[model samples]
Target: MPGGRPPSLRTVASWILTHPDALPEKERLKLKSVLAGCPELDALAEHVRSFGQMLTQLRGERLPEWIAAVRADDLPILHTFANGLERDLAAVTAGLSLPWSSGIVEDHVNRIKMIKRQIYGRAGFKLLRKRVLLAS
Candidate 1:
């Protein structure tokens, strides 16, 4: 707030989500200061870090406990997210527990969509089809 610009939302978000051991001293200090100033934020950060661990470690079995912990707190946004997960618990758990991902299929679909948009109004179905096939 004095000599330089404050960190952007993305920067601060990374600091919170990133493992503390990996952070440089300066960024860690900033994160500490921010967390110390707000108990709610500190709690949220702890819960988020735990959730991040669950994701990275493929510990989907911990989801229920995590949801309970989140609901115990006053963080409404996180509560909403947890609620959404509850509605489709099986799919979410399977996604977290499994090593496989549908990302490649999703990416291919996105590429096709992009190619279609790029060729829109510039060509007919034939040209669009050629480009899409070439893109594959």
Candidate 2:
């Protein structure tokens, strides 16, 4: 086989979860071979897909169980992610369960920042606020 640096396990796992059908037949076969060669990668791919499905389906109630499973695994990276989630579990659960999103708020904040930068030295807060209101 032609050789350079091999694909990282994470990259392969992500591909398997998100875009398996997007791969060319040859590449798909290669990925299957690689996965079959590594049981850990296979298990990691399964967990990744499961978590993705949970998020997509807004299954926030299952987050605790999923976090526990991740903690039980030998994967340090996933354990760290689970720990961070535990620190703000309520917010995370709310985000998953609520239909509302912060996208609009974030967009407004970004626009205000852009306006501030454009008028940095030329305008004061009052003018900036006026322009932001008008732009919106």
Candidate 3:
């Protein structure tokens, strides 16, 4: 026998095999070091290492009701929810055309200062609004 020993490999195997949920990172590393004293954990270690990837793959699955609901397009009776969806879609798809999409109105607002200065600040809000609408 060796002059010094931690324990028989069987002892380390039993310690890990019996406490599946006790494997915190620190404890897990310690257990791994001890397990290196034997080959018993090879299969268990491989499976444990793959557990997170397995869970991630499972999580990628769409829930049945979620798929059905998306297909149905049914939503609560709230205009805000629909409006929010519209805004999100607008932000994503640059191809979306709406009253707000064109920059003509924005350009008109930015030009208002120069237009007002040219007019010596005599233009009122109504005149400015009319000029902006016509410019756009």
Candidate 4:
């Protein structure tokens, strides 16, 4: 916890969920003791684990129930996440259920943005279009 470069909250959560055993022995022991000492933390961990399982398994049908449970649990951060997910429920469900991903499309968009930045104030539309086509 006290280091020049400490791990992020997301990193710590990921470590706890995906690779706790890979953590250093002292850190792992501390994590285990902390979790064992807190019932709320244990329950939250179980909730997150179940959500992760649903995501990995592409069980979009379970999302509504999961959101409800999160809301009922009154975890402020998770409740905010649930609310955002609810706002984009359709897109979230599609992402969970579909085998396809938008990663390639997003990559292309990012490349285009990079190219635009590189050519900003130095190029016209036609030249930029040509560069984009050629690059692709």
Candidate 5:
């Protein structure tokens, strides 16, 4: 109420996702009070923390158990997320557990898609190829 605007959605989401010890003292106290005021939010916090641990620890073998726990909660958004993960469960498990990732390849593919969109109606393959090559 004194110095700056309230925290933005991104900042709030980050606070919820980050480990408490990583947050500044002020932000940690604020988050503690907020979670204390709402039991549902408190439960959501626990679930998010558990999921974060699973990701960082490469415990993909716990995917099914995690999904089951999320589904047991009354959280519709997380339930939808769990359902989506179920659709490609094997890939999701592999991605979570493996030490390697296709992230770089995926980023390059995304870059090419953006470049194609930029030149879609304006260029022939020769020009497009030149631009794509130049993009690298």
Candidate 6:
């Protein structure tokens, strides 16, 4: 990232951004001359050219019309409920696989809760630690 060839997509995008005239005469001629001289920049220029064409096409189009077609029948009540529940379960399972699993860490919290219940207001920090480790 610091000292390497710029990524193809980003290089093309930045060139397009800075040079507002996508197919200006001077820029196009420079690209053509560079392409004639160097094969690698030629390939990059070709990609940038295609990307410019796509951007031009996108500028003239309207948003897709499919957004207005989703009715209640497209997503029933029960299916929507199940989809949300599935998302929650996937998030919880992903958290379990992280370097610090909340499940194991929650066990430590459960131990602290037990210690608090047993000690009430009397035990100091040292005795609480002794009780937790010995209990573990």
TM-score on alpha carbons, each prediction: 0.88, 0.76, 0.23, 0.75, 0.85, 0.30
Descending-lDDT candidate ranking: 1, 5, 2, 4, 6, 3
RMSD of each: 2.3, 3.1, 19.7, 4.0, 3.0, 17.5
Indicate the worst ten consecutive residues by lDDT in candidate 6.
60-69
Model 3: which ten-residue window has the lowest total lDDT? 59-68
Clash list (residue pairs), candidate 1: none
Candidate 5: clashing pairs of residues: none
User: lDDT score of model 6?
Assistant: 0.50
The whole-model C-alpha lDDT of candidate 2 against the native structure comes to 0.81
lDDT of 2 by residue, 1-136 (tens): 2365567867676577775667888778777777787777776777787788778788877889999887777888888888999999999988777778899999999999999999999978899989999998
Identify the candidate with maximal lDDT.
1
- Model 4, 28-131: lDDT tens digits are 76566656766676667767877887778888788899888888785788889888999989999888777888899999999999889989999799888988
lDDT of each: 0.91, 0.81, 0.48, 0.78, 0.87, 0.50
**Number of backbone clashes in candidate 4:** 0
Per-structure clash totals for the candidates: 0, 0, 0, 0, 0, 0
**Please, what are the lDDT tens digits per residue for candidate 5 over residues 59-104?**
9989999999888889999999999999999999998899998899
Give the per-residue lDDT of model 3 (tens digit) for 1-136: 2344455667655555544465566556656666575454553444333333333344313333332333344333323433554465434223332234458776766798666666666767888777757765
Candidate 1 wrongly placed segments (more than 4 Å): 1-9, 121-123
- Residue 107 accuracy (lDDT) in model 2: 95
For model 1, residues 18-133, the per-residue Cα lDDT tens digits are 99999999999888877887799899999989988889999999999999999999999999999999999999998888899999999999998999899889989999889988
**lDDT value, candidate 1, whole model:** 0.91
Worst 10 residues of 1 by lDDT: 1-10
